[model samples]
Target: MEYPLAAANACLNAITTVALIGGRVAIARGNREAHKRWMLSAVCLSGVFLVCYVMHHAQHGSVKFIGPDGARGIYFLILAPHIVLAASLVVLVPKLLWHSFRGNFDAHRRTASWTWPIWMIVSVSGVIVYVMNYLLWR
Candidate 1:
């Protein structure tokens, strides 16, 4: 159950990351409605992942790296950014969603501009963390 939660969290995070990028593309293509839908969906999916992610981590302690001290240090460095940005993303996401829902285009654009890259970083870092934990160190 824990691993499945982790896997689902990773998969959904990746999908939402892509959705955020695709939403930007949709905006660039002048498909405003499509962009809105995609962005909203991405936010929702990420929210779901966040909840499952919390559950997984609550059930499972920190994953260890099976390597030299140097490697472990590097792993923690990657983990730090992922954790920090993930926390930021959670706090900012709702504000972004609210602005979008209120039909505030400028506010949405500014918020999305910040959210997109952070979301991508959090998502990609999540996969890296998962691979390092479940595969490389397994």
Candidate 2:
């Protein structure tokens, strides 16, 4: 069965990915305030994603993939890291915000260097997983 809320979650992930990139570029351009705004927006979107995702899964429960076995392997491949990294966000994101909020730019930057890429992968892979599950397979 197709769950409509999954689409919304995927969109949130995609939007967060864009915001993450925007924040990175802003920092590179020496726009600290812009960077802060963009990153905060991304975090907010991600928080929304979590809420929507929980509501979504609570309603729909687990979804089984309908694709071929070969595709199933590929799906799990992407899903594994997405799951791991997405889980890490709970810790990584708060630490990131704390560093920035406490005026610890150096710590923030260091944490971002790792957190950013992990978050990006989780966001992008989430969209890809949604497509593979809802669009392509179905």
Candidate 3:
């Protein structure tokens, strides 16, 4: 993997992890502003990751995998969840940002209740995928 792509992926993971923390704080304190800021930042960060991801894939194609015993099944298992949630985040984060920005606090909160956990999973799983591709499989 290119250093730039790896770096961006790492940053995206870090920022989303922070956003999850900030999101918990927002929920506890009812801090809508902070919630909006952190969530939006997370979305933007993920967007950058997406762009870098597509570019890298387009330029270099995907890395092939060879796994240990049962590792092939496990790898696909992990990959399914990550891909599903990542796609969800791509679609849903904007809806969340829109609702929150529109001052629809109730709707935002409702949507985010679902979005936050999924986003967290996506972020963490993304890191796992990266590690598996570059480190474990290498």
Q: Over the full model, what C-alpha lDDT does candidate 3 score relative to the true structure?
A: 0.78
Residue-pair clash count for candidate 1: 0
Between which residue pairs do clashes occur in model 1? none
Name the TM-score of candidate 2: 0.97
Count of backbone collisions within predicted model 2:
0
Candidate 1: TM-score? 0.89
Tens-digit per-residue lDDT, 1-138, candidate 2: 457789999999999999999999999999999999999999999999999999999998878888999899999999999999999999999999999999999999999999999999999999999999888978
State the lDDT of candidate 1 residue by residue for 57-116, as single tens digits: 788866556766767777789889999998898778888878878988799789878778
Q: Which ten residues in a row have the lowest lDDT in candidate 3?
A: 1-10
Question: How close is each model in CA RMSD to the real structure?
Answer: 1.8, 1.1, 1.9
TM-score per candidate, chains pooled: 0.89, 0.97, 0.87
Q: Taking the tens digit of each residue's C-alpha lDDT, what string does model 3 give over 13-86?
A: 87778877886788689886786677667777788888888877887687676557667777778889989888
- 1 or 3, greater by lDDT: 1
Instruction: Provide the overall lDDT of each model, using Cα atoms, as 2-decimal numbers.
Output: 0.82, 0.94, 0.78
